[model samples]
Target chain A: MLTALARDLAAPLAANGSFLIKPGVGLMVWTLLVFGLTMVLLSKLAFPRISAALERRQKAIEESIDTAERTRAEAEQILAEYRQRLQEARAQADEIIQRARQTAEVQEREAKERGQEIVAEASQRAQREIEAATKRALEELRNEVADLTITATEKVTRKALDPEDQKRLVEEALREMDFSGLSSGASNN
Target chain B: MNATETGGLPPRPAPEEARIPAPHPTDDPAPKSSVKRKLLIALGVYLAGLIALIAIYGFKGHRNELFKPQNEFKLESWVDLGIFSINKAVLYLFIAAALTCVTMIYIARRMQQRPNKVQAAVEALFRLMHDNITASAMDERMAAKWFPFIGTLFLFILFSNLVGYIPLPTNTENEINVFGLQIPSFSLYAATANLSVPLVLALTVFVSYTVEGIRAKGPIGYLKGLIPGGVQGGMAVPIFFLEVLSNLMRILSLTIRLFANILAGHLIILFMAGALAVILGSAWLGWFTLPFGIILFAFEVGLVAALQAFIFATLTAIYLGGAVAKDH
Candidate 1:
């Protein structure tokens, strides 16, 4: 069956094209024409631009990377600066608090000393008032005692005595009445 | 009598004779498909290669010309271009260029600081080409001068190789006959499958390197430099001949490698479909042959297309490297 079919096979060149293992000049011309056109179009318009675009992409990527690095560095630097300022502010706040505490303590001490001085002045005034009252009371007691002495003298005598004599008597009576103790006590007070 | 009888029906390989594995019988059992994606990819390529081999064998001498009908496995011209000719390969070239042109133009217009999906993919390809081919070979300044040529070569060949995977009209009977003359049509186009395409690419590289070498070292200096100075005696003449010969071989090797790799892959895919048909004895293999062939084909051919383009570009850069180096 294989040989029969093979025998029936038509000559390759019969109304059909050849098995083009050998190169054709027409194909070569076409090849040159198409290839040349492709070359002109590509080199002139496509290849250079495309390759340049690729190179441009690469460059753009590199630029972005560099920018990223720079931005990161700047951000880190800013962060460091903020941290430093925060640390300084915290230290200053601590110092201010300490100074305020010390000032308050000094003020409290001054207030306490002034309060004691006021109390001492008030006590001194009360003492002076008491001394004046005592003096007044002693004066009144002496006056009353003298008047009673005079009355007793007049009652003992039937007729009224002369003023001078009575005064002398009263004076004698006060001198004889042991008033030295009273006088000594009043002087000690 | 099946394609598996390799003794009777080996694939008629291209003149370059790519190494293709024969199709395995079901009795042998199939290799497990569950593995790493990369390994699966490698394995799929291997299997797809076997299928392509079978297909090549089935369509032994399947090449055809547009107007002429006497040869096998050769593509004949449909329209003569004074200096060139057109066929499926030429059609593929036009398609490839238009595809690249439209895609690049779109991508170029739509390019942004933030790229969309298509833009991102194209950009990555550009960077890959520049770094791998241009930067790897020499310093940046010299690389810049040659990058466009190397880069364009890479993209063009890549698109052209990829276009082959499209299912367009190919083979002998698919031609449109007008007044007994046929015009070839192929949406399924693989430009690098044609030898002439790679030849032109290599020749361009060859000329570029030659020009660069002369520019770097004066013309006299370049010629003198080709003959190594360290060797003083009778060895000098032979060494110079050998060096010149190897330098010339760069063009031949560059041309052949690009042409053969993609052609082999394209043929492999063709053969795989044939092998499937032969094995199942039908155009339809109960949802097995075609869908599986397509899945396998996509992965395998896609990888080959990219790989060949890269290799060609890389070699060109290396040539440029040798040409523009400050010292010998």
Candidate 2:
């Protein structure tokens, strides 16, 4: 029975076995050759270039980063100094502006006080001149009015009286004039 | 406006803050925290299940039946031969294929967006195999060339080795009809149960390493490497013979190491699991030996799986590294 089973199994296995081994063995060897050749080509040609490129790239990146870092630090230092200077300048400008504003205010107050003093002096001088002119005009007007009254009275008396009458009128006039001069002198004293 | 007002305050840790300086590593990988709990939990669950099964089998006194070997269901006819060799262990090949396809495809897809835990685990394994194991030994560019072959070998062997510990239905009591007779069958066995499996794997390694060596150093250069440097006429002949012998020995050693480790691990698990029932005769005995056996089983399985994969990858890497040596 075991022999029968073995016999039955053998027939199909035999026919396919040779076919399987032919392809299997050949393909395996071919694949092995291809793989070996590939490894050779890669190790010789491919890998070195890639490895070199990688090393170059890494070095470049490191150098770039170093340069960037140095630049950044320098910029930061410059920024710090600039900020310090800017702050000091701002403070100084504020002080200068404050001083200028204070000086301007003092100058403005002095100008205003000088203007007010000039205005006061001009007003006082005008008042004094007006007072002296008014006094002189009043005295001149009083003397002129008295002379007109005397001339008019002499003309009216000449028309109405003769020569003898006129002489008497003149005598009366002279006596009155002398009394008036005495009164005038006493007032002036 | 202030940090505390928005509830962003640094947490007022309890008095035990001194004991635990940082968060768990699983929670936050920034600091070293004990993964003791999570690892223990995973181990504990595995142990509990394994122990429970062992206790149940032990109480029933089924050791002799469990360990008993009976031949069965082996194909004695031509129907078995095709692209794939049919056997119970070959199911592990399907498991490997399914695991690889599903895992790799799923990982490939998910890695495009977000990697899941299983994918991450697999990717990490692949990365360690490539970067630390392979690339560290050879140039990274050279390592990439050999990554696929070495990576696949590691994954297949690892998964196949691990599946052996799944406690599949592999008892000899199962009967099958063969040649008009009902015979007992060992239903489930480890893929590495047969030496042929690891032998084929080692053969693959042999072919790859030999081919790589021949390629890097030309055929003549490769042959010349067998000769000792600075040897005189009389000494050269003897040294050349020794070198040939050693090269032959390496093939045997690499094959045997992987085959033996996997085979021994499976045998030990079989015996331990089979005899677990007899060892737990008493309640106290069951409590003590059950944990011990289960713990040993779990650790052994995990260790063997990882270690075998590691060794296989390492050996392959070393072989390839030697082959591609420009300065040698």
Candidate 3:
């Protein structure tokens, strides 16, 4: 069977000549025409669309990258600005707290001073009133002593006396008494 | 009877000759033993078949029956119309062209940002041709201008080379009768295997680069630029002539490279498949040769087809780039 097939294959070799190198005019013309038509059709139809799609994808990717970079930068800028503002606010808060503390201290000192001044003025007025009362009591006590001395003299004589004699007697009695010592004792009381 | 009496077909083997020896029926206690017995029987049958083949058709006078290399590449027209006739090669070209257009257009129409399998494959192919072949050789502007031509060339040739590997019913000279209908036998043939196809393509590239060179530099300047730099006086003339000859040789180089590679690959496959057995006059030799044939077929399909296409396109780009280049 194989021998027969081989013989069949071998039969045409002598008559075929050199078909391998021989140029077929029809084949060449067809190749050129077909290749030319294919090239034109592809150039006009398929290649451009594919190239455009690829370019479009490339452009979109670049744009996305650019946008991402810009967004990141803007976010960083905003974050920095926010941090700066936060630091400023903290400084302002510290300053306000410091001022409040200082103001509180000064107010407390002023209040203490005003309380001391009020206490001192009250003690001074009380002392002045006491001194005036002591002086008036001493004067009243002296006048009462003169009247008592006159009554005692009249009782012992068992008769009435003139105004000049009574006054002289009373003066003599008052002079005999230690009035400096009495005034000093009254001031101590 | 011979193939001539059987209308270029071999007579079918008798039932006894075709049948594989059946294994003896076994009543084994274990299934494992049964499986092992079957495997051993299969191996024995294979070895027996090989031995039988060697004994029947030993080394003898069968060299004259071997298929010739030229017969495989013969171009007998299916339809002859004076100057324009359709042959197998022509049919392959039409198929390749149509496939190139349809696939390109279909993928172009359905392109996506995120692609499915087929779309991704097409896109990858596009990028390979555009970036690796066209853009890499030339600058962006030139690549853009010539991408369609170079891309189409690459795709057309690539399809042509690939489809060549697939066996098709185009061997009209050898027909087989099936259900009372005569059908052409299945055979591998490529359009690029023929000299005319690649020659035409190479000629196109040659014309393109030359025109581009002339367009970039005026006619006189383009001719003068062929001389290498630092060349002067009497040396310039010969150098310029050699350079022109070399430039002309690019067409032949391109043509022979594609045509020879594809033709040689197919011939090797044909030889390895059955021609070797026919020459050696041993039918058992086919069993050994078939594996090598399969391996060669794989190599041709996997690497040679795409590689040839890539080289052709890349060379075209280089020529175009060199032609328009300021240094050249």
Top candidate on lDDT is: 3
**Candidate 2 lDDT over residue span A65-182, tens digit each:** 9999999999999999999999999999999999999999999999899989998988777666655555565455445444444466657665455556555655565545544453
Taking the candidates one at a time, how many backbone clashes does each contain? 22, 2, 0
- Ranked by DockQ from best down, the candidates are 3, 1, 2
Compute the lDDT of residue B3 as modeled in candidate 2. Answer: 62
* Alpha-carbon deviation at B310 in model 3, angstroms: 1.1
State the displacement of the C-alpha of residue B99, model 3, in Å, after optimal TM-score superposition.
0.6
Could you give the CAPRI-style class of model 3?
acceptable
What is the DockQ for all candidates, taken in turn?
0.29, 0.03, 0.38
Off by over 4 Å in 1: A1-21, A108-189, B1-76, B80-83, B170-172, B175-187, B224-234, B275-292
Candidate 1 clashes: the total is 22
| Model 2 pairs whose backbones collide | A9-B78, B58-B277
Over B1-328, each residue of candidate 2 has an lDDT whose tens digit, in order, gives 4668659986665578577767665676533334676777867876776578556655343223222221221222222554443445455555654564455544444442244576557556756776777887778777878776676666666776777666554443565678987665444355554455665666678778778878888888876766756776888788878877876676777667776676556544543444333332333234444455666678867697778878877888887787667543
Chain A TM-score compared with the true chain A, each model in order: 0.60, 0.57, 0.51
TM-scores across all candidates? 0.65, 0.53, 0.69
List candidate 2 segments past 4 Å from native: A1-189, B1-66, B69-79, B82-85, B172-188, B227-235, B276-288
- Local lDDT at A178 for model 1: 68
The DockQ leader among the candidates is 3
Candidate 1 vs candidate 2: the TM-score winner is 1
lDDT of 3 at A27: 92
RMSD of each: 18.5, 15.1, 18.1
